[model samples]
Target: EGFLHRWSSARLMGRRSPSQRKRDDCESSGEDFDEDDEDDTENEPDTRKRKGGARRPGGGRRCPCGPTGCQRLVNETGFRLPANPERRLAWLQCWYPPDSVPEKYLEKKQFRVHECHFPADAIELKEFKKSGQVVRSVKKDRLPDVPFAQIRPAATDQPRPARGERQTREAADATRSELDRIREWVQHGVETEDLPQGSMEVLTAALAQGQQERDKHLRTKERLERTEKRLSQILSERDERERALRAEVRAPQAGVRGMNALSYARFCTDRWLKKSMSQWLFFDAVEQLNAYALLLDGYYPLADITFVPRQRAKKTVPPADGERAEMRRARVNYPQNRKPALALTPRDALVFWLFVTRSGMTLSRAGALFHISRGTAASCYVTMTEYQLQILRREFPRLSAQQIRDAIPDRFRKFAKQQGVKSDIGHILDGFEKQFECPRDDEVRAACWSSYKHLYTVKFLLGMLSSGAHYFTSRGNPGSVTDPDQVETSGFLDLLDEGIDTMVDKGFLVQESIQKRGCICWMPPKMRQNQKEATAEEADDTASIARIRIFVEHAVLRIKEWGWFSSRQSLSIQQADLHSDVVFIIAMLSNWRAPLIA
Candidate 1:
């Protein structure tokens, strides 16, 4: 009877199950329950005692029958329980302990409960129909009973055929009908003496057209083959000549190498020189190269760190006169007095360094291409890099506030005025990072790890003028350093004075530091600590500031395009000074390009 009542009530009340009803009641009553804990309670009744050994205070003794004993207690007490088994177990556990309860109920029952079952007549039928006493489901505007005649058509009593077989039969029927119609039409036409004219002439013309297209295709294919063969021959000759040049360079004779050099120069035409110079040497024209070579004239006898001699070992005793005399005699016997002169001039050495810097080629490969030893190549590279860095620093010094104001375009001046930007705005600042190899030491690795890039990197802060020319580039710092900290330590603040405004992106937090130096820092508006987003006015200010400040990032990109910074080899932490000098030189050289904004 209870089961029938439950079924009838569920069907009449929108077909919701008892568990869903219980959940709805709990939600309506504002009773929050831990569903996960209830599921565990049903799976293992003693989960709490097993996991935490926690017992409820002032509760009955632990029941040996586990969940079954608690359920019986709930029935005896006439306590309402949740419909879900898990939730029912959880509710019972709250009232009764694991031990069997010994409570007696005094409340009298108001209604009789009895079991309900189907009659013999109803059970005898193979198909059971819902009794009239039971309620029918009417949710979603659906009928409870559907007639068999309505469900299936009487004319089509057979089961449906497979899709593939059905489609094949339909296609065969269509083709047969179409063929019969055409045959009848032709028979009628023959009886009436009507037939298509010029049929053979149309067929002949189509065949001739196809033949012409085939001939054209054959001619095109033959032409392509001939062109490919000619190109292959040229490539083969070029490879042969390159092999002979390599052989001459490797030979010990200077004359052969000199002749090969002359031949190589002769092959490099003006067009080839222009293209190769811009790509491999970063110079636009031969005249630029000539002018650059002139810059190294006064910096004669450039010193290389690699050539610095090690400290002399302490002599225990003075060399013997006979030993010294024997060394002199041995030196005289060797070819060329055991000392070979340099094969390249100072200008050629400088060009060699630029080639290495622009192409990022390995020192060994560069040395072979230039017909010099690896050690000599290394010495030249180091020497030229050091001298060139010194010259660039002097050439690209930071501009004063007045010079920056003069260089800024008139359009930018008007925009700055409209945007309320100070007239003395000088430089825009931003920072960038270059990825490096992870160090073995934990401290070094942690220090170099960059959260922004999600890799180990070195960071540099760059400052550019409104005209997009870089004026200040900081030495490389650990990637873990923040933008504000890098700016403080990079000595850029020292150049700022009162009335000179410095622009920076939103990442910079150096307003206080810049103010301390008596300079105004113009950074984009940022959301406050308590705010989730900036106001409309603040967003407008940020957009206005970004319009001019983005050029600094563009300038930084130009600096990073150099082969040295973009090379596959990672920067050495041990030689941080050299890497810093390289970055400084590249940043300075980027100024030679046209302005980014213009």
Candidate 2:
């Protein structure tokens, strides 16, 4: 009757067992309810506590303590209680202390906080004062009343910030900042008993493991990309070799089809002889090839870094009438659109490419060594040099004021203490001379001879940044000219802007010219007998300037390491820009070897 009345009549039970009646009678009597003869509900295990002694009533989540006893319950543990009341109650039962004061323990909560940014100098001076140091230089009365990070502000003290305020720190980021150990919890949906007491430590360990796995995945991704790139390069090589083979197969049918018997025999014999040439040892390493070619490592100035020109038809004398007909060109297989004028193994091609940078080598010697014609070698040299000049022309660097600041070294602070930079722009410029070949033309030879060096030579102005990197190289000038004249003629002044300071040797002698452009010049003190010995300050200034200026000379030395440039035979009279181009290329190349400034 009770079940039918509690439920709708249509869903009523027909009868009740004696145990059920007994349980209902015990509940009504407000005593310990027992089901010793009965099992728990169908969903729970039989071993589940069902009665008293810390048992949960009806297997539902409620405080284990009675309502009267639970009024003093407190969330004292340093963890975020579960959102579910039942799970939270269960967690409290296991972790809550049994023998502590009954005072209520309230959980921590976050609240909106306000903060401020202030004149950082105020904070800095205050800290110094607290450390028992007197900073009398910057007076308290004249301090600026503003925040600053970007400027050369006036040399004055900063105003005091408002008293008793907390500074604002950036919001914590889980990815970039360390996780807080307290007042925070791991967000994983874990029950209290399922987690360790020091859950934050656990989370930190897990995050570390996750970071390591992410790094491993990134390394694997990079490795796969490198493998894919190498495979593609190999495929291209295979295709090129196959095309060349096909072209060779069709030679008799195409370029040499109409050759007479004698002409064909001679052609076949010459082809076999050329094919027999083998010189693989010259390019055992790519660096060796670059060194031989007077280039930086793993580079060429060609359209294809490895490709070479194909052999052209040999120049022949006028043929007599009725003579045996000769094939005008060699019969070989190649694609119609092939840009390479000749084909050889990449190694042999690199060998041929490097042959021109050698001094005192004629075209015949190069051809004999590489098994190519003298004309082809000469053509490759001309083409490669032009390409190098073009690339450098387009890609030269023009640094801004901020980059110039970065190029300045912290190591120069010692000098700055003595005499500081008033402006942001700065450079260390100097002139370097390299020997050149005396031209056959007497006028050109006389014009290029340097009285200082007493050798046929050319000079250039090199400017290096403070960070040990080459910034600029002036065009080649006649070595006969003075350093100041070389600098003026090479157009180094055109790059100067207001507030730039150029450091030069005693030879630059362009202080007035630099000052005219509204920039500063730092040069070593002159030692004239008419003048007394340098003062201590002047000596310090010269030493500082010399220390920085030495880097430009070191950069110049790196360029001259190329034997072709260091030796005396590389300069040419035919190409007006040849010496300049070589100087620029090597100066640029030095930037790759070691930075010039820092």
Candidate 3:
């Protein structure tokens, strides 16, 4: 009936379960009977009447045994009652008994009432409610303001267990493993464990190894330093011994005076007096004769001696029968005879010799010095130079007239042939020929020959100076000058001018000029010609002259260094030619002396 009533009420009000309504009615009626019994016997019967419809007579209220009620009773029997059930149960579905605790905690003997108890301040209300006393609301007290230093914060500073104390069974096993690794490092020079598992052991072994290596390195460095010091000491001692030995070796050779005497003697013997004295004397005589020839003749003699036949039949036949006798006579009257030798006197001979020896002498100066007329001096100087050249050929058998002819170039020989030039041998024999056509007066021809020979000498000398070639001589001082006459004559100057002209013609000289007179002369053709209005022909001519003249000048300066050419002496044409050959030989020697350039 309770279940029915509860279900009926639940259905009507949607509030009570069937079991809950039965339990509630039983409690209400039982409470009312108790109240009636205390009040009056008369009310007990009404309570009983009230319960009659739902309750059995003489039996307590029928037990409400629905599935939900039974289950609730079972759950309630398992639950513990709280000290203040009404209040505590309001927010709780279940409670724990005072003795209830985790089994593990209990087994470990760590469980205690104090471990689960609330704070002392929270127990008052709980106790009052459990005793059914009237509870009053109590205001919570405000916490005191605590200083930051006094407050216990989280355990940031807690000391960890020391290595010695961390000895739980598991930790002890790990420690034993670490010990074994250290022992392995000591015994085998390596760690048994990997880096991650035994980082500390690895680090310790590495440090120890590094320390040993450092000690060994330091010892090696000390040994090296000691070795270096010993080596340096030995080297210094050896150097000192060497110096002392050198000083001892040099001691006996230290007299300056003796050394100087030896040096001077060597200089005189080797350089100054190159050959035997006899050779020098012979050369001196030859040199003097050459000067004499230049003094008498205005020009030098022929370089090589030449010989002419003393007598020859005149080429004369009977005139053609038709030719008029008068015409023949007139033609014959034009001096049919040629003088073979030029007229040269004894004084003329001396002057000629002097002139050949000294290249040339001023006419006035010669006259004044020798006490003669200037014209006479000039005449003698010119005539005698040619005569001495002829005499030289006679005296020197090695030199021949044919050789002189051969020395001339083929072109010149051809020209001579075309001109029908005749060689005179005995022109000096006749007074009429000498008086009418004097050989002494032919200065120009003599000068030309003299100049030619001098040019050869200059060329040789120049080659020696420029190239450092050696000039050998039987007399031994090839560089020394013996015949001053060979050099002083204007022969070299004439040759230079001729060379320059030849060079200019060949387009080896260049020049600059605004006008004809303003032209720069003898410049190399390789350089540009700067003649403002020059014709190409004119520039080319000038350039040729410039090229040939430069070499000639260089040759002249080199020969001039020897005192022979520098002195004031006259030279005959013959002496000049001989000197030229000598100079040529020297130049050849010079050429041979130098090493061949790659």
Stretches of candidate 3 exceeding 4 Å from the true structure: 1-348, 351-361, 388-525, 528-551, 557-598
Give the winner by lDDT: 1 or 2.
1
Query: Candidate order by lDDT, highest to lowest?
Result: 1, 2, 3
Clashing residue pairs, candidate 1?
A: 62-98, 62-99, 63-98, 63-99, 63-100
Q: Lowest lDDT 10-mer window, candidate 2?
A: 108-117
lDDT score for residue 416 of model 2? 58
lDDT of 1 by residue, 450-528 (tens): 9998989999888877777878878889899988889889998898867767888888999999888777788888888
Candidate numbers, best TM-score first, in rank order: 1, 2, 3
lDDT by residue for model 2 (1-598), tens: 8876776653355234455655777889998776564454323434433342222334323332223222222222112334444443443343245454122221312110011111344333323746786432222232222322222243346553346743223422442344443224335544445555566565666688789999999999999999999999999999998886454433422233242211212322455423422221123344444453454222443335533445464466645433323422444333432354443433344344434443335544544444444555556555556666666555566877766776677665456555744554377787677777778888778878989888988787887776777778888777788887777777778878677677788888999988998887877888888887888878987877777667777877776655446554556555556666656765664565536543
The lDDT of model 2 is 0.55
* lDDT winner, 2 or 3: 2
What CA root-mean-square deviation does each model show from the true structure?
25.4, 31.8, 51.0
TM-score: the better of candidates 1 and 3: 1
